[model samples]
Target: MPKILPLFAKALTDSWRSTLGWAVGLTAACMLYLPLYPSIGGSAQMQDLINALPPEMTKALNYDQIASGPGYTQATMFGLLGFLLMSMASIGWGAAAVAGDEESGLLELTLAHSVTRAQVVLERALAMVVRIAFLSVLVFLVVLGLNGPSQLGIDVGHLTGAVLLFAALALFSGTAALFAGALTGRKMYAVAAGAAVAVLGYVFNAVGRQSPDVEWLLNLSPYHWAYGNSPVANGADWGAVAGLFGISAAFIVLGSLALRQRDVGV
Candidate 1:
């Protein structure tokens, strides 16, 4: 068997286990709220809820009326943004896949074989891609299943867009793990940094929504572009999707280069 496959397989296994709860939580939350969507938080109901919500609560939730339609409401207002809370799951996965092995000195052992440093890094990144792809598939299915009745409801494009967006985020966080592995040589730090980036991005996105003047700051946060469901609610933003993939690619490439340049077990 190929060496990378084992690494990739292990990563996929671990990532699946790690994100299982998040997927469940996402599905459960959407399922639970979906029943209440009509009177509890659809277009007309959401309008009243928004009016009643305090400014701070509204700001935290990114409450926007455009995200109030049946299909879009659950995805945009609830499902799509769940990654903000679940990102730590990816972060933990990234950290364990990379720095955890390194910390155990398995990285040096693996490199002692036929694998080169670049191969190690590439395989690790590939593992992340596979892992995140699994998460994306789960999320898409769960969201689609929960909103199954939205025939003219849930926008397929919007749903696919949101999945791609989160995949990009997972890639971005996974890349940061490489940097954390190289710099700190510690899994904990790598995990924490990835989690922080994901969480902070959501916080910034919230801030941007609440205050238009500082909205420019939203550009810096991944959450700003993660709202593919937003475009579905109103009009999807092709630019946001492009920007997300573009930025995520940059981070992954830069992190790979950095990993290659560094000496392992340093």
Candidate 2:
């Protein structure tokens, strides 16, 4: 057999169980929430109820488009639950990839072999990318399978755009954690950094939506980059997609360079 990149292979092998769990849990979440859209969002009574709710509440929760099929899926799954699940899983993996391993002294052992520090950082980052992509694909399949049954009415092309952008957003958070870990060699710091990115992005997007004056805040948010135009309904914004991928790539490069300069397990 050809010799593969050992670190990358090992990372994937070590993470299979947790990755599987995330896939299953997220799939279940999608199934549970999607099937109810017809009864709630598709109902005239529910539309009335939604209209009766305060405008502020609707804006904050992004329910402005909840009465439609694409809007319902965007609101319930991609916007809320899917975002939470993907962010948490990606952040944990990114932080643990380097900082967690170093803390446990496994990184030191790995580096003792023929692996260069740059390889270690880059390969770990690759593992994270793969895992996030895997989960995103799983989500797409689940949603696609239920699209007809649940009457989501999302365009196939648009749904693909939504999932890709969603995955990029999650990857962006994970890379933040990865960068923090490489810079500080501390898992706690990595986790904090990653969580901060997700939370602050969300807050900025939410507050920006509240008024025209503060809408500029959306320019600073990754959440805005992903759902600013409601990709599920409007289709993919390639510019925003490029921005996400660019930022993520930048993080990986910076993190790898920083890791190269640090002494592991010190």
Candidate 3:
């Protein structure tokens, strides 16, 4: 390992088992929901069931497009279940990157070495991204394999965009936790910060869909930014993708600055 990135290597090695578990969960979910789409996606009964849902419920659940292959995949796999799983994993990794380490007295030992604080922050963030990308790649491949059989008709390009957006959303929450962890050196606070961002973004997006009057709430929502316009059915909104990545980078900078100012393991 490079002298500057030993922490990064350690992060990945320590989390490999956890990452594998998450990948298994994602693969299982894909196998379960995606293969069933052919039977459930085209039925009159499914359409009637969806139509019976209230407008708010329809939009909030993202079930309005459930009849289509892309829509079904986005609602069940990428947007809902995948998003949930990735967010939790990312937050756990992010929080552990700093606060969890400090609380366990590992961070101070790393800092006592020659590696700078900034390197620790950036490399930790990079490790988190790598693990997330691994899971996302698995999701992409599994869905693509099932595409023909499930008759989803998903465009390869659009599906790529959706999966990337999903990863970015998870990064957003993860980086938020990282920032909080660096700022407070408290895992509980970091977890709450990460969870709060996801919860609030979800609520904001749901409310924003209620009416144009409050639709401005969507503008404030990272969830909307990630999933708006159905990136699975359509090409990704690159602007939103860039925005999420940019924010995550900012979290690294802010986190490094905060960690540098504080006393680790104090």
Number of colliding residue pairs in each model? 1, 0, 0
Q: Write the per-residue lDDT of candidate 2 for residues 1-266, one digit (tens) a residue.
A: 64688788989999999999999989999999899999999999999999999987787778888898899899889998899999999999989988988998888888888888889889989999999999999999999999999998989999999999999999999999999998899999999999999989988988999999999999999998899899999898999889998999999999989999988898
Candidate 3's error at 251, in angstroms?
Answer: 0.5
- lDDT by candidate, in order shown: 0.63, 0.92, 0.92
lDDT of 1 by residue, 1-266 (tens): 56546655665675565567767776665565555555545557667767877876665565544345544453443334556544655676667655787888887887778766655666667776666677678767766775655332667677676567667766676667666765566888887778777777777777777767978868878777666245445444667667766765665566566656767676
Worst 10 contiguous positions by lDDT, candidate 1 = 70-79
Clash count, candidate 3: 0
What overall lDDT, based on C-alpha atoms, would model 2 receive against the true structure? Answer: 0.92
Deviating ranges (above 4 Å) for candidate 3: 1-4
* lDDT per residue as tens, model 3, 76-109: 8887888889999999999999999999998887
lDDT of 3 at 15: 95
Better candidate number, 1 or 2, judged by lDDT: 2
Query: How much does each candidate deviate from the true structure in C-alpha RMSD?
Result: 3.2, 1.1, 1.2
